[model samples]
Structure formats: C-alpha cells, structure tokens
Target: MKRNNFHTHVFRCGHAVGDEERMVQAAIENGLVELGFSCHIPMPRYRRHLLKGTIEERSINNIPSFIRKLILGGPNMRMPYSQRHIHLKEVQRVKEKYKDEIQIFQGFEAEYFEDYQDYYQELLDSNTVEYLILGHHFDRSSINERYYGRAILEDKDVLKYASQVVQALETNLYSYVCHPDLFMIGKRTWSPACQEATTQICKKAKELSIPLELNSGGIRRGLREIEGVVNYPYPYDEFWKIASEIGNDVVLGIDAHFPNNFKEENYQNLELFAKRFSLHVIENFTFRKGKSNK
Candidate 1:
C-alpha cells in the first residue's frame, strides 16, 4: 500500500512538537506519498468556554494548563482560536512548497461538541480544511471531567463514547473515525460491557461506510498489562476483534504529534495490530462534504 498519514499534529495544538514545514519535510524524507495535518480544531470564543466551567472540571495533572487558560487563554488543549488563521496559512505555504514531493492536506482532528457544530460546517463549507476526522478525545465538552482517554472507567462512560461516536458519524462531516477504541485507554478490562460498547461503534461505522483508524498514538505509550494481557492502550485487541467480526473498513493513523511519529516503526506496529485481528485495513478515505455543499 502507498504510505500516507492524515492524522498529523503540530506544536500549535499545545501538546505536540514540530511545525508544519518540519512535518511535511519529514513525510517527504520518509517516502510518504501524502501527509495531512490534523491538529486539534480550535474553537471560537474558547476562553468563554473555559470560563463556563470551574477548575474542578480539569484533571489534577492539567492544573498548570488550567491556570494558563484562566489568564492567557492561549493554546493549551487546542490551538487558541487566534492561531487558527496562521496555522492554515502556513500549511498552505508548505503544501505549495512541497507539492512536487508529496501531497499535503489540511484537516482538523475534531471532537463532537454541540456548540461548535455550526462552526465546523462553516470550516468545511469555506474550504478551510480538506477534511475532518472524528477524534473524540473528550466527552460533552473539551475540558470536562468525562474525558474518554483518562477519566472513563465504567460501562456508562464507555457506552457514552459509543453513543456519541455514532452521533458524530451521523453528521457525515468526518472523513474517518480516529481511535474508535480511545475509550480503552481508560477502561482497559475486556469485559462484557467493553465488548458491548466496542460493538456499537464498529456496527455503526460499518453501516456508515466510514473507516475506523487503528491509531499509533496509543502505541507510543508502549505495551502494558491490561488484565494480564500486554498491549497498547488503543488499537485495543478486543475492540478490533469486534470490528473485525463486523467487517468494517479500517485505516492506520499515525496520529502524529511529532515529525518523527511518521517513522516506519509506528506504521509497522499498526500493520501488526491489523494482522493480529484480521482487520480490513484500507489506505485511503472519502472526505465527507459539509452542509454548505447542500
């Protein structure tokens, strides 16, 4: 299969390293045919959203960021809204500069926030990005207690992840689902409840003809024993097992936070995971059109 990655991120997102040009250059050096920048989508009036909730909404480790949000209201979880324009402009410049070497795309890895639904549509309608991928990191709101990765530990939240993922897919705004098993990062036990939740996401993606991404970001954490089975936090074995049974299309996402994340090791691990579960991993995706296309 031709090498490509559509889940790339950069320093503007506040949790990543490297810049757009550096990542694009890295992709070219790695012999990738295509590279898509999918940094976290910046929200309008992000500071207001931060202020709407109390500090209790933030996790203990994120206290320093909470303080940053309170005063500076600059990039933390996502790029500050003010930085969005500059990020887009820079990507355009790099895409043009690297056009002869590789295909570069602009995209955002977005969560399903009800308040920003219209804004998301606007982004698509205006051709602000080439595509969007559903990376449902948080629940309800971006800075909430119901984080899918860190806070979820029970069936209710995992089920919520499934329900909301289905809802995000129904909108037809996302090209693919990034880390459908992100809930597994928090709830590791492969219990009946976990199976049920995974089943929901797999079945719906199969129905929508949307591809589920086996994210390499989780693999960066390395293997650990979850219920005595050593594995990466996501591309979670049991989750992909259900997805395999459902015969859903799967894609490999580097989920690149740094330029080096595009290295062959991550892709190899993603392939190994796919082979382990007999996942039908596809190499390309369809970019869903926004409401404005109507």
Candidate 2:
C-alpha cells in the first residue's frame, strides 16, 4: 500500500509533541506519499466555561497543585484563536514548500458540539481549514456533561456515544470519522448492548458511505488488559468485525501525536487488524479543495 496518513497533530494541541515541520520530515522519511496535518482546532473562547467547572476541572484539581499549574500554564490543551491562525499560516507554508516531494494537507480534527455548530461553520467560512475529521471525544453536545471514551463506562452510554457519532456523520461536514470505536475505550466486556450500539453505528456509516478510521494510536498506547483479557478501544476487534460484516468503508489513521508515531510497525498492525476483520482498507483518500476530504 502507498503510505498515507491524514490524522496528525502538532504541539499546538498541547498534548502532542514536535513541530509541524518535523512531522512532515518524518512522513517523508517514512516514504509517505501523502500526509495531512489534522491538528485539534481551538475551541471558541466563550466556550471556555464548558471546560472550566466540568470533569476536567475536578481532574485538574486532583492533580498536585504544581503539576496542575504546569498543565494550566501550557499550550497543551487546545490552541487559542490567534495561535490557530498562525499555525494555519505555517501549515500553508509547509504544504507549499513540500509540494513537489509530497502531498501535504491542512485540516482539523473537530469535536462535534451541537451548540458550537455555528462556530465550526465560521471556521469553514474563514477558509483556514481545508478538511475536517469528526473526532467525537465526548458524549453530549455539552462536553462538560459527559465524556464518552474516558469517563463514561456504562453500556447505555455506548449507545449515546454511537448516536453522537452517527449525528456527526449525518452533518456531512466531515471527511471521515476518527476512532469510531472510541466509545468502547473503557468498556471491558462485549455485551448485547455494546453489540447493538456498534451495529447501529456501522449501519449508519455504511448507509452514509462514510469511512471509519482504524486508529493505530490505540496500539501505541498499549492494550488495556482487564481481568487478564486484552481490549483495544479503537481498532477494537468486535467493532471492526461488525463493520466488516456491514461492508463499511475503512481507513487507517495514525492519529499521530508525535513525529515518530508514523512508523512501519503501526501501519503493519493496522493492516493486520483490517485483514483479521476482512475489511477492505482504503489506501489513499482524495483531498477535497474546500471541503472535508472523503
């Protein structure tokens, strides 16, 4: 398969490491024909309150005061508006600079908040982003209410998360869904509820012709072994099995938080997972000029 990775991040997201240029170089070194920088977009400033007194606040407060201070002071969260503009400009420069060597794209891994739909539309109107991928890390439109992947554990929450993903896909605003099985992150056992929720998501994706990403970052994080059994939230076998049965389009996402994450081993693992599920993984995604790449 020709090497291509569309889901990538940079230091502006606060959690990811390395500069954008280094990420591009790493892609080239890995012999990738195409690389897309889909960094986390900065949330609107007015919505800062959504994160302030929520679960994130409690989590931050629990951290030792000094470590909390370090996290609060850093740009490791979402990029501020001004910083996002500067980052986009830099990405444009890099894309043009490496035009001949590789196909570089600028995009954002956007979270779907119903209340923030207008905010996303404004971003698109600005023409700062070339593509957007739906990365639903939270359950409710009000993310402060419930975080699906990390915090929510009940099987019922799985349906909520899957429904949110389906809604995001219905918007027709995203090129693809990233980590569609992320809702199963903390889920340990496969149950009837889980199966039903996953089926709903898979059917919707198949009907919409949306490609679900088999994220490799989950592998890099290592498998979560609960009660002597290993579980992967993304690239989750059970979910992919259903997706394959439904014949939904599948794509491999590096979800690269660092330059080194674009490794041959990760690619191999993704391929193996796809093969295990009998999935036909899409190798290269076409980049749409002024819309989400499909």
TM-score, candidate 1, is 0.94
lDDT of 2 by residue, 107-135 (tens): 88877777666666656656767678888
TM-score per prediction, in order, is 0.94, 0.87
Q: RMSD in angstroms, all models?
A: 1.9, 3.5
Relative to the true structure, candidate 1 has a C-alpha RMSD (angstroms) of 1.9
TM-score for model 2? 0.87
Write one digit per residue (lDDT tens) for candidate 1, span 25-70: 8899888999999998888877676655454364535767777865
Output the number of the TM-score-best candidate: 1
| lDDT of prediction 2 | 0.76
| Pairs clashing within candidate 1 | none
